[model samples]
Target: MKILVVDDDIHILELVSIHLRQAGYTVVKAMNGLEALKVVDREWPDLAVVDVMMPGMDGYTLTKKLREDTEIPVLLLTAKGEMEDKERGFLAGSDDYLVKPFEPKELLFRIHAILRRYDKAVDRMIQVGPLLINRQSYEVVLGKKSLLLPLKEFELLSVLASRHSQVFTREVLVERVWGFDYEGDEQTLSVHIKRLRDKLEKLTNQVKIVTVRGVGYKLEVSE
Candidate 1:
């Protein structure tokens, strides 16, 4: 999963990024709200970690703006601890609030909590053709049979299934499914794609991951 971190403090931004990366999540950073929005446009993160105080667009306003169009989970991470401050944060569309001087583990806990809530809200599954992916259980069903997948492989399939036949360039898939900071190259992605396809073909050949050579890939449904 990808997380966007927005903080005016460079130290905090790097700190959060490092911790999140170590936890196996891809992290994107922004020094302020405006920059954060631009990153969001590019990364489309599953969640955002935003500081409450910024020069032009404070966390509250930014949260409100995001809520206007998207349900992307927002976690307010700032030194502001007043009851009123948290209330304002919720009113402005924050899903969780965390006070600064916080533990890295605690932050991860909250991140998982917020993401779980978001998943539940959406029913934790995406269906395309005969494939049904259960996000919570991390299982995919092709017709009546279930295929097990590793985390990265499951995420990769989720992206393709969600978009169904839409061709996705390698760069786009890397950013959307693996995060903008994906350290691997086409070889890594190709390996995962092949694994998913190999396992999927064993169960059913009704769905296929089609390669649009010189471009990218798309999921195709067959009779």
Candidate 2:
């Protein structure tokens, strides 16, 4: 897999690149967000390790721009270990966050975890019932008809559909869809669920996602 390591610190960039290369990945190095964008435009990497602080464009802006174009997984590296910083990273579209002074093994583990999650998402798309999510095309289909979905809505549906019939608490949904450090209110999940239900209602009268009342929610496949 090809991976991009973006950091203003040359030493840090080289360190990460060396370890990632050792782990059998093609490593691409970028010193700043502008360079990162240029590199991404030329070559699409499977994953990116972006440092939060940079000279020209910051990592948050880079991550947001990248997310707007593609769903390629991004792991943000931050020097600040504050919870708010982590939350901001997630809000900006980081798939994972790692604090500075992290172990190389931990970085490798996180990369593997993100890749595993992405693979599961791909597998789930094939069996999302009447709903078809084409990641490559960024298109959603309900049966033979196409349905338009906002980015967040698509992400929410992807997570729930992946574990059809399994109960996912509001917290779990927030973490999985919104990211672990998301500071948003629990009502956000409810609002998204309602919107998703409305859209899917057009396809099938029966609700695929069921409310678990006091617990959370679950997706039910109709027979």
Candidate 3:
């Protein structure tokens, strides 16, 4: 997962980035809220760690702006420990808050907890007919058999299974499975869908990935 860390303090920015990287996350840093917003447009991080106090565009404003268009989770960091400050942070749409001078381990724990909560809320486990897609474990199981798929293919399946029988445009699928900045063409999507169909055919015919002619694709689950 990717994390964006915004802090006016150079030392705090580097410290947080180093710890997040050590915890196996891609880290992007910004010195202020304006820079953080720019980085977010370019990076599309899964979460953001923002310092509450800044010269301009304070963390509260930044968090509110982020929540306006995207659901990216925010964790506020501040030196203030008062309840009012924390309440303001929450009202700004922060998923969690951490006081400064915090232990690195505690930061890591909170990040993990926030991510888990998001995962649970965003399709942690999806069941479509006889197929099971476990987002938490990244596993796809059909009855007693497990289907091993490449990461992209698995992500594609997960996206489709998240909303069974829902039509997803090729553009939308590409953006979700591959990043918005993906350079590949729709052929990449076609190939993956073909592979997924072949795999499913070998196992069971209960589920099918059907192309909606001029529209897109949908996962059809039969009873």
Candidate 4:
């Protein structure tokens, strides 16, 4: 697979590119966001590793531009590790975020995880009655309306909708949706499920999230 490395700092850019090459990935280098876009147009790399701080367009803007045009996954490599920074990166359509001064191994691991998630969801479309879930675009359409959801909520819904009527255990759902390394308890999953349920209920009566007494949740679609 080909990977694009975008960073204003020459040393950091080279460092990331070398690591990706060592992992058997073809590497394309770009100094800034504009150059990165040009490289994207030419190289058509499978994924991009971008630095948040750049000279012209920042990583967030570049991510938005890429999302607007392509389904290529983006991993934001930034020094900003705060919650708000991570939130901004995700909101800008980044597939994942890693704070700077990170281990190359960790970076590779995140890239693999993102790629695996994308592979599983690529071209996958789930329809339940009037509700439609397009995994590639992260879009949820109910009847004639599109419902926007936060990243986690969207992921949770996709997981359930992929296997509607199957009773998924809380542990399994949490692992699949939030990752096994998630530090929070099951309450986080519950909260997101609640939000998804509320949103679906507000839009349609045919699709429902049913909670099993001892188990987790299942999505039910009525014709």
Candidate 5:
């Protein structure tokens, strides 16, 4: 899963990212709320780890802005441990809240809990043309065949299928699928797209990931 970590402290950001990456999560970092918004505009991470204190925008406003458009999970990780602060975070749409000096294990546990709950409540099955993606099952069916795909590839396809015909820039695609802080270049996305294309070609030729030249790519359904 992809997680966006927002904090003014570089040490905190790095510490959090390290632990999250070690736990097999793609980590995206933002120094403050402004950068967080830019990252969110393109990335749409599965969850956000935001600190309450910052220079430009505080965590409360950031959470509020995020809740305005997306239902993506938000977890407030801050130094404020007061009951009032926790209540404010909840009111701001934070799904979970953890104070500073927290154990990394506890953080991980909370993340898993939130994700599990969200997955259960959400309808993750998506139908795009002849392809059917069961995210909860981590499987995809094309025509009559059930195909197995690597995690990243499956997620990439899921994102593309989620917004059929909408062109996604390489940057946007990487942010959404691989996380905004992905270390690989655009070549990585190309490789995955190629692999997806090869597998998809075996299924049929009606649906395609169309390249839009200067723009990026779009899922083209020939009907």
Candidate 6:
């Protein structure tokens, strides 16, 4: 997987890029928000690690821009340990937050945690007939064929499948799939749900993620 590291401090950027590369991921470096944006447009990384403070544009602004176009996971690095700073990061669409003066292991752990959450979101693939989900690999197999899913779509499916018959409100899905402390609009969950439904249609004609109208949604085995 490809990771982008955006920071004004060259030393910090180098340190993070080196460690990410060592962990078997391709690393892309950006010095400021503008540079990060350009890199994102060109490379389309699997994930991004951004520093809060910068000269050209701040991490918050960059994160907002990225969210408008993509659902790539973002991990914010903030020097300020204030609650306000952390809240601001979430409000701007970051998936996770890490305070500065952090150990490399902690950074690695956060990245792994985010990836693991993405994986867990699809921990089970319910087969109600022709549908098949390989929860371990996040692969959806449909009658001897497989479909490729984006990260958010995969996460959304996982969340619904894990609960099976249980209904989940949009608020719960946003918190569970995004993060417990996420502050983005609830509509983001709708977008992901729509995408998942569209993809699942290719496998089966049934509605796997059922809308519960006044309640929320449930993944039911089609009758």
C-alpha TM-score for every candidate: 0.65, 0.56, 0.63, 0.56, 0.69, 0.56
* Candidate 4 off by > 4 Å: 124-223
lDDT at position 115, candidate 6: 78
Clashing pairs in 3: none
Query: Residues 1-223, candidate 3, lDDT per residue (tens digit)?
Result: 7899999999999999999998988788999999999887666678999999999899999999999967799999999999999999999999999998999999999999999999777856788899888876777788799887889988998878766777888877887899766897779999999999999888779999999998778899998
Instruction: Give the distance in Å from residue 80's predicted Cα in candidate 5 to where it truly belongs.
Output: 1.5
Runs in model 3 deviating more than 4 A are: 124-151, 157-223
Ten contiguous residues minimizing lDDT sum, candidate 4: 172-181
RMSD of each: 5.2, 16.1, 7.1, 14.8, 4.9, 13.4
State the displacement of the C-alpha of residue 131, model 1, in Å, after optimal TM-score superposition: 12
The residue ranges of model 1 lying beyond 4 angstroms of the native Cα positions read 124-169, 174-223
Runs of candidate 5 with Cα error greater than 4 angstroms are 125-157, 164-166, 169-210, 219-223
Q: How accurate locally, in lDDT, is each candidate?
A: 0.86, 0.83, 0.89, 0.87, 0.88, 0.81
Alpha-carbon deviation at 89 in model 6, angstroms? 0.7
* Tens digit per residue, CA lDDT, model 1, 41-160: 666678999999889999999898788856688999879799999999999999999999999999999999999887777767887777788988999986678877899999888888
Clashing pairs in 4: none
User: What TM-score would candidate 6 get against the native?
Assistant: 0.56
Kindly report which residue stretches of model 2 are placed more than 4 angstroms away from their true locations once superposed: 123-223
Q: Choose 3 or 6, whichever is better by TM-score.
A: 3
User: Highest TM-score among the candidates is held by which one?
Assistant: 5
Backbone clashes under 3 angstroms, per model: 0, 0, 0, 0, 0, 2
Residue 146, model 6: lDDT of 88
